[model samples]
Target chain A: MLELSRRRFLIGVGLSGLAVASPRLMAAGSSAGEQTFHSRPIPSTGESVPAIGMGTWITFNVGGDQYLIDERTRVLETFLERNGTVIDCSPMYGSAADVIGAGLDKLGAHDRIFAATKIWTSDGSETREQAATSERRWGIDRFDLLQVHNLLAWQEHLVTLKEMKAEGRVRYLGITTSHGRRHRELARIMETEPLDFVQLTYNVLDREAEERLLPLARERGIAVIVNRPFQGGSLFRRFQSEPLPSWAPEAGVGNWAEFFLKFIISHPAVTCAIPATTRVEHMQENMGAMYGQLPDTSQRRMMADYVRQL
Target chain B: MSGATWLSYSLQDFVMFGPEVFLRLFARINQDLWPWLLLWPLAGLVLPWFGRQAAELPRRLAMALAGLAWIGCGYLFLVRYYGPVNWPATRFGWAFVVQGLFLLILKGRALPGPMAWPVAVSWWLAVLLLPWLSVLEMPDLWAIALFGLAPGVTVAATVLLFAGQPSPLRWLLLMLPLVWSLFSAATYWALGTFWLMGFPVATLVLLVVALRFNPSPAQNPGSQSVHRGPGRQSP
Candidate 1:
């Protein structure tokens, strides 16, 4: 009996070592070489998307520099190569939408992309106009998701978004806020509004959402798309130097990027985590989180505890 | 948002683009305006020679060159390049053109006295040394941001060119530099590209020194001598 138990322990250790060696094999969740990313359902429609998405806040706003634009296209290609779907942008993000359009035009992958953008004007009556402009920039007939950015004129924008949804111009409608601003107001919207998704800031460090907004999202049957999953790159700046905890492999975190991203997407309320990156390697690292084993409740507590101590 | 709510935000929240894209603007603009880029620094190099002349036409020509620099930068760099990434740059670009027009239309004259040696050194530093600063940071010849082409260097040198001019015109012309300095500083700080922050800081410093050393008519008794050249009209 002693020899049998020892043999089982050695096998477990060998498998864990192999998992650390090839994250793709580990992400497959089995011995199969084919990888599978975790997908979460839109409670309203039952449609689902991979838990990892790309954000275009600063990373994609390359403007008229054709060189930079081409570089961004490659980043998009890397994303699509990995089967990434949801890509979120905003008009307030300057030329990001246009750059994305240019990239999509080059790749001709508009059909495969789940284009998500925001209506950011303060004028409540300009919802349709803003959406149209965004559509023109994205070179798409419709946006998969149209969000009232930062709850700006949310009431009026929501009404128009609903109209557009009925008109088949937008697939989903939602509201967004970031840096943990206006949570009380966002919570009110989540409680009262007919939202398909709610995007907000939630990461390992920024846990204020865990108290109310996240729980409310789950209760309202609203999908949650997390923004600033890396807290605008501050998470890596802070935690990159620290050693990954012994249990990191158990949670399937290969590097700091996956470590931070997996924590957010692993949350039951989060449908996806949009972590923006300018580098193709970082995108690959971020998408790696979509695969692999997610931490359970006890392991999550342990993850948070380790970071707080650091 | 309330003040309490505003506290939740930080500088990174307001900044959309990273330093890589911002610094690459120099290389991109340099490629777009090659050969013509040389004229800007040439215009900058001759301004002091014009400033030394007692003739009003030379001084006026100097101001016109400065005006052209502003318009060129405003159009090429801000409007065509930076505006796409940062939307508000377009409005600032138009304002720069207006400032350029002001420089072109305004009469120019030599200062009543020789420019302070320190102020001369600062102007030379801005024109000669400032463009290479970006090269030091980016380590590329194309990344060199020249005066009259790059806003930070152009604004810095302009404050010195108009140093001998009488205000409220001097103060009026200096306003944009001051604003640009603060705005650029904030942007660089938020992007965590502390190296580029020096450009705006240098502009602000030169602005302060120029304003201090070159006093206006109300402040200096000898200010009247600036209007002593041929065809000059006294206020």
Candidate 2:
């Protein structure tokens, strides 16, 4: 199987999105032996997304700069090379959706891509128009997920999203909040409303989500997409001077990137962790966390405590 | 940096460009235009007129100009210009366009009645503060604090100069710049440039003041000012 995957990776599907088989990804393992890519179900439809995904906050917001766009294309290629899906973007992130679309078009990787973006307006009319604009920007017919950014006018947009879902314009509907801004309001909405997913900030340092939001998601069967898994790059700045914990390889955690990511996805309710990156090597490192052995519950606590000590 | 050095580097290294880059970009956009010197001053003149008099024309004209400001920031600054250099400007361009339209149809007094001293102070501060930006010791190209174009200045002026009650339409118009001010504050901090933190702070302060001085419905229902947008005749 590994041999076949090597052939497929070398010459696969013309870089077609999902079908670009990457079984060879399992061959190159962390401290652990060979392992396959891990995926979690999107609780609503039971369809699985890769445990790792890409985010386009500041990283992909390079507007109209062709040089940067080409550089980002290299990053996307590396991501696909490592078998990534679920590229998350928002109109609020400047020209990210456009840049991502441009990169995917360059690579002919659209077929395998599972794209997601947000409807970020306060009114229903704007929401409808922005969603359409997002569709055009991403160069995709229907989004896998359409989130209400920061719950701005969520009440009005929710009605429109539901209708869009019914009309086959969007595959799933969810809402996002970040910076730990509105968890209580988010919780009430999760309990009262039916949604496929909820995107929020959750990391080793910011474990507040574990208190209610994560468990609520588990109970409500809502897949959680974790953002700011690096706390907007705060994690690296904090730990870059320190060496990786000597025993990190015990859980297949090779480096800080994998360590931070493994801790995020190890949570039972997490569907994926979308960490943005502009460099190909960083993309490779981020994707490496996907094949590793995730820490068990007690081990997760240990990882958290270890980081807290630092 | 060597290849290994680069690979090991973190996100701080990847953010690309410095604070001066952004400020210079804005300055380049404002290049050699003396006519624009009067833009904000004139808007300042029109902004407070929403409240002092009963004539709807001044308020309408201000709202129309406010629309132009939104579209100016959206199209002239954000899309046609800034977007080519920055990604946020593209989406923000859409925001400006939407806000400009919202203002075009907006109905209300700029203030419910006589301008509050706080509002007046805030407006004067927005204009007077321009020269003081020299104290910021920023690069000449980076000295952009014009209304309608910059984020925080836009927010302060929007709230301070708003005519009347917070209708759904008015709030819709206010939402983007309010959000943009916060984003701008954080971005400036990251870029290590002007603290620019005051935009969001001033916006909140003005909002609190406006809510307090707001007129009761009995005082100004704004029924006459609120009319359907163009081509839709009143019954």
Best by TM-score: 1
lDDT value for candidate 2?
Answer: 0.71
Question: Each model's TM-score, in the order given?
Answer: 0.90, 0.60
Per-residue accuracy of model 1 over B1-235 as CA lDDT, tens digit each: 7899878778777888988899899999998888878988988887767655556667667778888999988988899989988877888898899998877776364344444556667788889988887887788899998988899889888887566566665667777878888888888889777778878878877877876766565655554554654322222
Q: Model 1, range A1-310, lDDT digits (tens) per residue? A: 1122332344345435545766564342221332535767788986667688999999999888788899999999998877677899999999999999999999987766778999999999999999999989998877889999999989999999999988777888999999889999999989998999999999989999999999999999999999999988888999899999988987777898988888898788899999988889998899888776777788889889999999
Residue pairs whose backbone atoms clash in candidate 2: A17-A112, A18-A112, B109-B163, B110-B162, B110-B163, B111-B163
Worst 10 residues of 1 chain B by lDDT: B226-235
lDDT of each: 0.82, 0.71
Candidate 2 local Cα displacement, residue A258, angstroms? 0.5
Candidate 1: regions farther than 4 A off = A1-36, B109-118, B212-227, B230-235
